[model samples]
Target: MGCKSCGSGTNEDGTPKGCGSKGACNTSSCNQRSTYDWLSDLGIDDPYAASIVEVSFKNGASKDFYYAPSELEVFTGDNVAVETKNGYNVGRITLSGELVRLQMKKKKVREEKVTESIIRRANTRDMERLAEVRDMERSTLVKARAIARSNHSKMKITDVEFQGDGKKATIYYTCDERVDFRELVRQFSHQFRIKIEMRQIGPRQESARLGGIGSCGRELCCSTWLSDFSSVNTAAARYQNIAINQAKLSGQCGRLKCCLNYELDTYMEALEVFPKKADKLRTEAGLAILIKTDIFKGIMYYTYKENRGLLYPIPVAKVHEILAMNKAGDKPIDLQSNQLVVEEKDDVFGYEDVTGAIELPAEKRRKKRRKKKSGTNAKGRSSGSGRKPASGDSRAKTGEAKTSNTGDKPAAGGETKEGSRSSKRRRGRSNNRNKKRGENASAGPKASSGGGDKPANKPSTPKPTGEGGKGGSSSSGRKKRTPRRKKRGGDAPKGD
Candidate 1:
């Protein structure tokens, strides 16, 4: 959205950085290459604010001035219906107030000649109908081309625009030779059931009507704000010291880009300071022919027959002195001896590469993974977990790990370690609760279940952690361990 045309993109916010049309940033503010209304922000109430206003139709493909009725309020970017030759057409206000007078004067359009009056601001119904009418253009274009091709017409129908009321349509086209579209128009009227306008235009105008992205990666200026297409020639490139690349110079219209003439005047003014017809110079190193010129630098590069690949850059003043000397029957020592030293800068893409060594995070991660796998693959694996004490760690490592391993162990009390901790009391009264639960379990029916036949003080042995443990060995004064469920989908995939 940071494009220049998107300056007046929003209704009240400050100008956006870009014209949204450059990409698919179809914001509401980007009303088909709208110009930002900077004057409106001045907040000065002009007496002639509601004069004739310039309106943009079809997203600026065409524009016309409409007289703004003093009774009605109007502003730039307002959608208003204006009078047409046949019916009312909808267009957005682009220029109004005092600016309209300046534009009219520039275009030499008489204010009295602007007879069309603004009918009214388009309402909801009118906006909806306008959308429906525009949606028909895509399919209409396809059908239009088919009808023309069936009639064996050589012209290509570039675009189709329907009237606001949907009672008439205009078909724009381009052709090299004259075409008889009388029969084509008759078929169009019968099929479309409306008035048909067959408008013939040149290639440039055709491209302007149906806009496209230019080679410069922007919307065609003709479709945006470029109302006129000036003739461009190869001379503009030569004057600016540009290579005459036809493919690069050509535009979407298959002609030289109109932008070629944008800075042509500036190049012309700069070239006024350069000496013309100074292509060759007689020197001791042989005849030096002009190779290239740095126009802004006022330096000209030349190559001699003796040094074919090498080039010597000479200033304009020095070239003139040598030319005057040659005219007086004198030759300089050599073009190189009098050449200006052009400093070569090693710059690339606005950035420079500094050579140094640094470690890549990805490589470091890979090395860490290799170290982790090597460390984990080595056994006892259980000791690294720091779970059991120093001596019991070796015994725990012999066990094949379960899918779900418990971090908590059973306390001396009948209650398991997980069930015994009662929130903060465990932090404040840990020993008291364990001792109390043990005393209670030892005194009651839990006591009968605790030691039933064997005595409670006997030390217990570490049973095998897997499948062979006994289920009926509750006589060991310890809770019977329940077998863990096998993992779903059989064994899990191997890597951690």
Candidate 2:
């Protein structure tokens, strides 16, 4: 297997064997920033190529210029062991040949400052060690964070990197202000038992190093291709008519989104076409003031100074004409016009028309009316018990009616002087009707007969005990009630 940076290596049998489809995939990915060597692919070799090679560490997290040996022939995607002051580090070669010279010059890195050089190409053993160190980076980061915490250092550890030989580690941290590094480094070095590097970076740089998807649903520009970060301000949003909402306007860096400045120049150019000194227009109806501008549509929206609820859109040419008319001592009738109305699309395609179609019946609860307090009538007697009397008791019903007609007061000890009888137990409506009929029949005979005299057909009061259909001694607590006989026409009172 070889580094498949160029995607153009071969096998011994003359068949393609590199990272292409013709061969088995032996791609040891080294390309992170996606660079292509145009000269190498074209089979062109420059006689005056730079000796300095650009090596990327941590898959393009960082890049440093290293002097390449004249004798060593580096291939695409080749991993090289570079010389650091502490130990050797492994990195992939991203740039070589004269292009590297141009990169160095563009970065303004002087050749004399380039002190380190490539020792040799990464062999099997070096790669194995490189993998081992890379695996330890996560654990190393956790331990470094713990160490920094133990030291009470005011810094956030973002990432950790280990040398190929595992002899040194670089800890990337972020801090707002200067920190006391002497104590932190002493503790870290003793704890890890290796050379400790405290590298500081900004919040944006931290996000760039640790790549992630952005709010735009794509890879971060910083991690993908954007290398330079410039200042962004709210003026960019204002020029484009965007709302000044902090949450939507800011990116993951807690700063104004870089995309805000992408089309800012175009917006600025468009804004220049808007007329100046046209914030107000004098009219006979009232004074109208400019509210906003539609740069592309060439419309300027204005509102009456007294009525801001309605907006009137006037063409740029019409606005200029009005300004000229005003300058010539003339005034328009009013700001309102047919063009002031902005038509909005009434039909939305994606959503279902569910308005008033789905009805949910509201739950209705019947409120129980409060029962009026029962009290005695004008006479000093209880109308009924604390509840409703039996339906057959005609006397009790009459008393209750009289009690209600008069303002009854409560009796002593009882809940009220006369509590109206609400049904104490459940009873059938038929039973109540039958009881009322019996009460009517019994009342008719009683009313016809004389008041004090007993009726002839009525049964007499029982003696001590009546049995065997004859008057006799009664049994104790076991006597059965006799059924009432129906009244006959012959038994009717003579008065009727």
Candidate 3:
């Protein structure tokens, strides 16, 4: 028979070996508390040593001490049938030898009160009966819950367990108030044909019996190693400076998480040196109110009453000094008088603030457009006596003309050459205009009167006309010749 405690198979003598009460498993996987019998390993000093043993039932949910007869030779992990009030009960031996004494003392169980004795190692028939009883527990639990609900009972049935003999069943439940299930038990016994026992438990005990995963992504402490439940409240959360949100603080048991108490002692010890009545500090500007306390860093945050939004962190010692000064009828000039200076640590990669240093390629495009607007205005004034197109005027017509002449498939090299020539012409016109304007200014009224009229007509530059004529003639010829080639090809086909 395989031991249910550790799930290990039969030992060499065909007896089951459970997780020995050594507080550890032989395989090192089971975390259920087991005792290591160092006395057995070192050899028992007396062969007739007191054979008081600890046995666990229902996989350690319940445990009790049993007297083992010396002649039976029972060991840890041996499934044994023990005597109970009704008939007999079966459990796996978890501890033996000198270790059982220490375990009893830890649990405050007296050896003389342990009247139960192991009858014999569970035989094949006994093991089979235990398996049958174990299968009935689930269905029994569901039916018991329905019975309780149908009868309008306030109790919540959490779990059910049947004795190995299949003679009795224990129903575990939780409720806010006491429930008298006297009639409910009569109905359950009639339905299941067994002795019914109702055991009332707390919410935490119910959660432990019905195991579940906690928010920490591990098995619940109540279900795993934590056997005792301590009172957890919002005070533990306040000491740790945790938010008082109920949903965040609650655990699987719908109570404040037990983990909140784990680190509370450390927080309390660190907060001891902080001043208690330093909630408000007097300053020349205004009264600074306490915002928060950083126990680890020994800093206290305070904000001016006039400007509650702005907070300044002051060292614990400095805050005490300021408070002492205020108590003595003197106030500091400002809350910042004892401000804490936090040193900046250099990053491993030498991090830099490049928020302002980022330069987008699109910004260069915007600058190019602005420069083009200014240049075009200057060119228009110099060439055509300031008769320039409005800024909103569409340049699409000229752009379309270029696109049509180029057939939208112009070579990249050809486009670059054309662009360079146009730029050169604009530069040349600008320079010539500049020279004329300077000469007019130096030559006074005579030069202006004589040259102004001539320059006005000279606005019709040969460079633009020459370039326009070339593009127009080439486009017109290409359009005219394409139809003639199609006509010639059509005529040849008809003649053939």
TM-scores, all candidates, are 0.64, 0.63, 0.63
Writing each residue's lDDT as its tens digit, candidate 3 over 1-496 gives 4454456676675544533332223532233433445554443464556689888777666778999998998776677899999988888776787778778888898987999899998987997899899998989888888888999999989999889899989898889998888999899999999998889888888877787888889878777667578899899999888989999999888988988989999999998999989989998989899998888999899998888877899999998899899889998899766798778878667689897799656543343443222123232443312222345442221332133233334221122111233433443344344545442211111111111212221112111223244212132233211111123344542100
Instruction: List the pairs of residues colliding in candidate 2.
Output: 375-418, 387-421, 388-421, 388-422, 410-417, 411-417, 465-472, 465-473, 465-474
Sort the predicted structures by lDDT, highest score first.
3, 2, 1
On lDDT, the leading prediction is: 3
As for model 2, its CA RMSD to the true structure in angstroms is 13.8
* lDDT (C-alpha, whole model) for all candidates: 0.66, 0.67, 0.67
Best by TM-score: 1
In every candidate, how many clashes are there? Answer: 8, 9, 9
Query: Model 2 reaches what TM-score against the true structure?
Result: 0.63
Candidate 2, 1-496: lDDT as tens digits: 3333334456766534543222222332344443545555545667888888888887778889999988987744567899998779988777778778777777899999999999998887997898888899998788888887887888999998888899998889999999989888888898888998889998888888887878989877777667568889998898899999999998887778888989998888887867789999999878999888899888999889998998888988888888898999999888775244567999878988897899889899999855432333223332233343444332334354323334533222232222232321111122223334332221111111123232222222223334453322234434222223234554633321
lDDT of 3 at 223: 72
Query: What TM value does model 3 have?
Result: 0.63
Q: What is the model-wide C-alpha lDDT for candidate 3?
A: 0.67
lDDT of 2 at 234: 95
